[model samples]
Target: MKIGVLALQGAFYEHRKMIEQLGAECIEIRQLSDLTSNRFDGLMLPGGESTVQGKLLAELGITEPLRNLINAGTPVLATCAGLILLAEEIEGGEKPYLGTLPVAVKRNAFGRQLGSFEYTGSVGDLKDFKMTFIRAPIITAGHSDEVQTTAVFEDKIVAVKYRNQIGLAFHPELDQDTRIHEEFLELCKSFSLNK
Candidate 1:
């Protein structure tokens, strides 16, 4: 399977490495041409500044096409700021970016860089996985019946899934575990089969 990693900013390389380790082709999506020229079985939006990534996606004319792909059921695994980008609404009145996922998020809910932390949490049926949070956002509420909470930490919703889209408030790429990434690949495989 081929996976596209949004490389405009943040931790794209780490994600690419992880995906490659799983024997998938990893494409770094840096420019508008990358989106048009390549076919991706899945997409990974890595942790970064949500505002900056949003602005760059629009400026590079990659926003709509990427959104269309997501809407068309391309499996996406979004992490940290990527979660904020997929959120339909932001706490404290921030403009929504892609709004592909059906969750309302609270940005930096864990605070700033100094507030970054690591926690072992239960992710769906998987338990005791290491979650690394770096200026993460928490899903305060889910707005769609299709949306399901996948993981929780400190009573806060940290991971959610809506159809083929999965959003995590922590960086699984930074951790030693590959369950989340493997699960995402399974989603991609399922989407490919259905298509």
Candidate 2:
């Protein structure tokens, strides 16, 4: 399967490497042509500055097409700031970017860079995986019918799934464990087969 990693900024390279290690073709999407010219089975929106990424997507003419693909049920794995982008609502009245996932997220809910930390937690049925949070967001609430909380930390929602899309408040790409990536690939495979 082929996966596109939004390479405008942040941890995109890590996501690309993880996807490639999982035996899939990884494409780095940096410009408008990358999105328009390539066909991908899935897309990875890596952890980055949500505002900057949002602005770049629009400036590069990628926002609408990418949003359309996501809304069309293309599988996606979004982490950290990517989670903020996918949220339908953001805390403190910030405008959502993609707004594909039916969840409300609060940016930097875990505090700033100084508040960054790591913990071993379970993601859905996946257990004891290390999760790293760096200025992460938290899913404060979700649309019960459309979203399911898959993981939690300290009573805070850290991961959620809506259809083929998964939004993680922690960075799974920063760890050695590949289970999360594997799960995403599985989603991509299922999506491909169904398509």
* Best-matching candidate per lDDT: 1
What residue pairs clash in candidate 1, if any at all?
none
lDDT of each: 0.92, 0.91
lDDT of 2 by residue, 1-195 (tens): 999999999999999998899899999999988988987899999998999999898899888899999988889999998998888899898877888888898889978999999989789999898999999999999876878888999999999998989999999999889999999999999888888
Give me candidate 2's TM-score against the actual structure: 0.98
Residue 151's C-alpha lDDT in candidate 1? 90
Candidate 1 per-residue lDDT over residues 1-195, each given as its tens digit: 989999999999999999999999999998989988998899999999999999999999998899999999999999998999888999999889899998899999988999999999788888899999999899999999999998988889999999889999999999779999999999888887778
Clashing pairs in 2: none
Off by over 4 Å in 1: none
User: Which ranges of candidate 2 are over 4 A from the true structure?
Assistant: none
**Residue 72 miss distance in model 1 (angstroms):** 0.2
Give me the overall lDDT of model 2. Answer: 0.91
